[model samples]
Target: MTTSPPLIISVSGIRGIVGASFTDDTVRRFAHAFATELPMNARILLARDTRPSGENFAAVAIKALAEAGCHVFDLGVCATPAAKLMVLELQAHAALILTASHNPADWNGMKLVRADGIFLDAAAGRRVESAYHRSKRRTGDGRVESVARDDVESRLLRRILDVVDVDAIRAAHLRVAVDPCNGTGALFLPRLFEALAVSAHFIHDTPDGQFAHEPEPIAENLVDLSRAVTEAGCQVGFATDPDADRVALVGETGQPLGEDLTLALAVQVVTERRKGPVVTTLSTSQVVTDAATANGCPVILTPVGEVHVVDAMVAEGAVIGGEGNGGVILTDVDPGRDAAVGIALILESLARNGRPLTELAAALPQYSIEKRKVSCSEQDLQRALDGLVQRYPEALRHPVQDGVKLYMEGTFQCPWIHLRPSNTEPVVRIIAECEQRQDAVELCAVAEGLLRGE
Candidate 1:
């Protein structure tokens, strides 16, 4: 029998195609590593999304943690952020979320959180990976047993409600449309909307492990959401990925508001209420930077990933943070990405501004960004990056991070370009930001030319 490589292990967690990179043995190894890294007798929180294989992976993870002598609290079929919140609410030493986020239904993975509810950074992830690789198997007595599920769910929901002004949201009386993509968000979002007294139109809200569309909430995949929002005359439409860690919005006019706007709007909401530092990944749109600056706040840029952004947030004591892909991180609630929190924050912004969702979104600065990926082997990646750097030496600003990011000055059209290799795929992703779409597209073409040795 052929065995797959353990679901792409790294600083954050393991994620890969089900029955391929992720299997029971792989889950056990990684969980054991996590257990070893955490303190002995540590109480760990475990939760899974509504994937067909989630329960199997969760079972393996629980048993591994238990065998490592850790107490486990299992919350079945919960959003990724909910697991993080439970870690902080329950005062557990760590939390493990079994989800693949926006990946296909056939994929499953895990995200790790510390006791403080922050995702593990690159260095910490490496440590866990090393431990996973080195750990020796110990016999029985180290397995997870069931705990109280209802109590945990109730407490988690209450914690979420306490952070937002439920009455204020109700007063707005905004009609909202939500598509959970048939993931774990379906488990809690309806109850949350009811508590806020908002009228919600739901699609793909069942936890059936059957995705109504592509699991990603990107613009191309949100056509139904856009139509539903306009047809229902909803104030706004929100869609979450499989794990519910990220969210995408559709404007009232059935127009898909880019994912970057989600973060931009959330930043506007949070910074308006409480002025503080904001953090976002480098690939994020400048709208977030503009929003933060307008509110007398500075935007901190990190490498592309939730953990990197959260780490910067913690260091800067940021009030709110998020990524370009619609993942909002509210530090006051939990440093991890939370789609539910994002919905409440956006509604709060609307209520406070006394404006419609479209109007609020229209007020932000506009810019164009184009993203493209090219498949390349490891050798070709190194060669292409070297060539690009050599061709545009004057434009280089930083190169020590995940990939090379260039800042265009002088008469150059685009403002910036970020080129990074994918962690999960054999592709190099190039993102260009400019004042015009044509310029951004042209820059991507230039990047492709360089990669192809043209």
Candidate 2:
């Protein structure tokens, strides 16, 4: 999964090895394809993460968009969510963020965002893909514009501040530790903390793209971050990928709280003050269900990916929705998954509750989540799913949606196994969550058995 040099195109976006699959030609062609759909004189927002190959790819994209007769607004070294907010705040026609997110340092990609601060939906994604193959460039020229970096950070931070209580957070005098993975998050997190007047001890705070560790912010990769939380005497620790869209947390006890808690904790903050439905994907943790239900809010489960979660929130009028991978989509601020907003919500939750983050996290119903993956072709994954359905006839099968989601609700206590092919990679992801750790692990074993033709 580390820079395999295989180009992957999905609803998630386009990702590949920097020089191999994701080349100058790839960026130019994709940008041209995206530009073909835009009207002349359209103001386009362009941003990139701190990846080594990001600037080169961004130049290719800027050239393509400019050649297409669109006004290009370049906000250098900006997080994915910040760029998304810039699109809506500046009223840009569209936006392109050059980031592979948690992908390896050698890998790079582009996330095409709409003007409303959300990623492209299925229909729009197809249009961009079709344009890439068509390779048609609109005949004309436009100029590139530059935005002040301070201005860029302020706009997104203001949106999050508007939705959260700054006075409450400042009064808590909470000290927090943050690990931005030396990505664009460093450009955003510090400023937001300063605005909230929260005490933050920041590590890996440079944006040079030299990641201090594995960039995913998972528990295994966050041991250093976990240690820093207790070492710094902070209430909580936060980690973000290069783009800062997804955020994982570490508790005051020097424990990795897992990425799922990011959304669950944010839901605790948002729903306590405001009332609205909660939205998330099938891969999200069961803790979210417990939190939402306890608050008298219904949960809408969508397919994997933040775009689907955002779409469901828009349709259902949900206040907050995001993927389980440390993404919190606050619809009130921007539809994108913003770690900046996640930070605000977490601080506000601690401030309002007058409790440590450890207690706040423990207050949520505990659940065990086991995540595993199998490297196989898509057809092979489907074959395994079919075999699984044949073996477990009692399970409810959902075939037409994202993947094979087998629900075991009536007999089991909210236990489910969702076996879905990875849209961004050539593999099948097996996610199982339940009230017990053994039950979650057993569910994964069931999928593994099916994959092994047991």
The candidate scoring highest on TM-score is 2
Q: Name the best candidate (by lDDT).
A: 2
User: Per-residue lDDT for 109-144 in model 1, tens only?
Assistant: 888888888878788888888887787444334435
TM-score for each candidate, following the candidate numbering: 0.93, 0.96
lDDT of each: 0.81, 0.86
Task: Kindly list the per-residue Cα lDDT of model 2 for residues 28-88, writing each as its tens digit.
Answer: 9999899888898889999999997888888989998999998999998888888888888
Could you tell me the lDDT of residue 166 within candidate 2? 87
List candidate 2 stretches off by more than 4 Å: 1-5, 398-400, 411-413
Backbone clashes, candidate 1: 2
Model 1 residue 347 CA deviation (Å) reads 1.1
